[model samples]
Target: MNRFVRWLSASALALLATIVLLPQPAAAAPIPCGHDCLGISRDAICWEKEWCAVPIEIKGTLPKEGYALPYRTADGTASAPADYTEVREGVLWLKPGGSLQLEVFVEGDSVRERGETFLIEYLDREGRVVATATVVIRDGV
Candidate 1:
C-alpha cells in the first residue's frame, strides 16, 4: 500500500512537470510582403522614415490573452512586448481625430530615426478588414 501511494504521487509530479514545460502558441515568422501590404497583421508590419518617435493608440480587440505581438520597423528592425494598457472606461478609445501620444526615443547621439506605422486600422466583423491608415513619426528630424 505504501509503495502504491508513492508511485501515484510520483506520477502526478511527473505529469505536472511535463505540462509546465509545454510550449505556448508561437506566432509564425512573418512572411514577406507579396504585393504591397499597407497594414500590420499576422504576417508582418513594415515601415520607413528617419529619426522619429510616435505613440500609437491601438484601438480594437486583441487576440487571446497574452498573445505575443511583434513590432517591426522599416529598417529591418522590431521592438515589442509593447506597452499594452488594459481596457477600461475611456481606456484605448479613439475618436475620428482623437489620438494617443506615445514616445519612442532611440539610442545613439547622432543616429537618425525614421519609423512609420504602415497600417494602423482595426479588423472588422468576419475578421476581414475595413479602414486602414498609416502613422509616420520622424524623431529629431
Candidate 2:
C-alpha cells in the first residue's frame, strides 16, 4: 500500500509538471481594418513632378451588384496647385472584389524642402467620411 501511494504521487507530479510546462496558445491580434475598409497600396510615396498613381483597395466582401464610393483630396502639409494638382471630388466604382487606382499630378520644384503630406478621404452615400489615406510627398532630389 505504501509503494502504491508513492507511485501514484509520483505520477500525479509528473502529470502536473507536463501540464504546467506545455506551450500555451497565443492571443490573436486585433485587425486594423474591417468590412468595407478602404486602404492604399502604398502608405507613403515619393514624388518628382511626374504623374503618380495611388492604388486604392477595398477590403472584405462586397455586394454582388457593385459598390460606389465618393472620394476627395484634402490638403495636409501639402496644398493644391502648389504641391500637387487637386482632385476636388470623384466617384470610384468598384465591382465585387475589385480595386481602383487614382492618377495624381504632383508638382516638382528644385527648391529644397521637407516632405509634405496630403489626404484622400473616402465617403459614404450620405457624404460622411468613412476612411482616409495619407499620401506623403517626399522630395525627389
TM-score of each: 0.25, 0.62
Off by over 4 Å in 2: 1-42, 97-99
lDDT of 2 at 49: 91
Instruction: Encode model 2's per-residue lDDT on 25-141: one tens digit a residue.
Output: 543221123365444334448585977766665556555666666778899999997998888778766666555666678898888899999877777677777666677898887
State the C-alpha lDDT per candidate.
Answer: 0.35, 0.70
Show the lowest summed lDDT stretch of 10 residues, model 1: 81-90
The prediction achieving the highest lDDT against the true structure is 2
Model 1 ranges off by over 4 Å: 1-110
Residue 118 miss distance in model 1 (angstroms): 3.1
